[model samples]
Target: MNRLDFLKHLGLLSAGAAILPTNFSSIKQSPFTELRGGIGMFSMQGGTIGWYTTDGAIVVIDSQFPDPAHAFVEGISAFGTGPQKVLFNSHHHGDHTGGNLVFENDGYTIIAQKNVPALQRTAAQNSDNEANQAYAATTFENEFSFDAGDETINAKYYGPAHTKGDSVIWFENANIAHMGDLVFNRLYPFIDRNGGAMISGWINLLETVAAKANSETLFIFGHGKPEFGVTGSREDLLHKRDFLSHLLEYTQKGIDAGRSREEITSRTSFDEFPEHISPSNFLSLPRNLDVAWLELTNS
Candidate 1:
């Protein structure tokens, strides 16, 4: 029998694993990997941060957590004396925007989608930290673009995918797209249903965004499995799309068969799509299944 046939016969290749690296704390240093068009991605914690230097300005996308944000601030300062610093929030998620204060304190202009501040404020309030939270003062409805020396960085909202506030930050000259949590690479993704995530719509948006990108475009993912890392191309975006689509389809199929929430989500895995097994973000696959179930049945 063929490998696929043998797997079917043996009932092997069941569920996938969600694996988290055991050495997260050891990732303290701020490592910068250069991409196309004088842009780079930096990671300390919570979503990858994208930075660019071309003209006389520096732009940073997604400010990770507070401590890491401080490290990022110091790293960018060493790049040059470009006093014009701008920080962007890819969405209202704390991991991606918790460090807004790191730049705000230094007089950097903070930017994000219009819905971000409210979500940030609500999240802060939940933690009883509304008084100390840093939110983007500059907001855009759909598209925002600005020139920083020789490059024009652009931010555009694709309308409620990862979150209602999700925005795509693009380096125009370099063709590098910072997908935020919109593209989780090989890892299972966090479906922020509470934050207005639409799995079906999100799948469509993934294809929409992927369509805009060319073969040479370099995409930076918000998170990825330990082995996959956080950088890829159009194929990476489509891979994520496939995962979400399969999750939605699997959940709907169970629902159509009169399955309860637990009955549908209790499955060890979506046997049809086992490529995204990561014990690191283990909750994502099952959580996404639950969210998709609720979205299909309730909404």
Candidate 2:
């Protein structure tokens, strides 16, 4: 059999289904999308949760918050009788890892980047909620891989792009990739500089991820505007990269003109980029600018 036939036999390389927020809201449940190769995504409140089931075993890529995670667990359980479960955190963010305990308490081994626990623990302590966390039981420095039958699920760190512990989860056979908070679709994203997010590094990371995906690959995003929604193609990833690049350029120009931090921060949004600046969360632009300014001036 040829490669295309082999992939077809595996139920991969097909056109994808785009998920809309309204679809989830109307159902009154966290949205569940079935992809090729037994892979799917569940969007609740935080980062999108990616899951793969093969041979009665399920491997989860990120768990949203606790409340949504609970609902997600229940919703997905109906898909199959997959007694085995494992979880992975795309980053240390609460929205991504908050629901880990749901799975952890259910006997799943929670995994993450090596830097996750420290950030997770620190965020919990800072909020005085250390007892509420579902920290990762396993951590890796570079990459981690798990093979369930012929479907290969792999995760790799691209450095402090979205956060210090950020990584991308890939469902190899299905050609589906979960970007967590890395690609925020067309909405303005939270650049967690407090958690080691660097704008320049984030730009590079998007390029790296975009290159790995072909025209057929379906990408799931962490968050999107109410109208924009998540789950898109590689072009969406490049859209974010271009936005960040323009943001850096715009900020650098302001700095070169000797604008104070406050002056730069005072600007609500970049003139040319509507993709990264949301009117409702207009304040986020200044915050990202503040960080971009600091990174450019300091480095």
For candidate 2, the 10 contiguous residues with the lowest summed lDDT are 11-20
Model 1, 75-170: lDDT tens digits are: 776665467888899998877887888779977899999999998898788878675568888999999999876677899998888888999998
- Over 4 Å off, model 2: 1-30, 277-283
lDDT accuracy of residue 251 in candidate 2: 90
What are the TM-scores, per candidate, against the unseen true structure?
0.88, 0.87
Tell me the alpha-carbon RMSD of every candidate: 7.0, 9.2
TM-score for candidate 1, please give it.
0.88
lDDT of each: 0.77, 0.76
lDDT of 2 by residue, 1-299 (tens): 76544422222100011111222322454378787778888765566788887777888888766777777778877775466788988888776777788888877888899999999999889878788788888899989998876678888998888788888989888899888889776666678788999899999999999999999999888776545567899998998999889878889999889988888877776667755534234226777787888789884
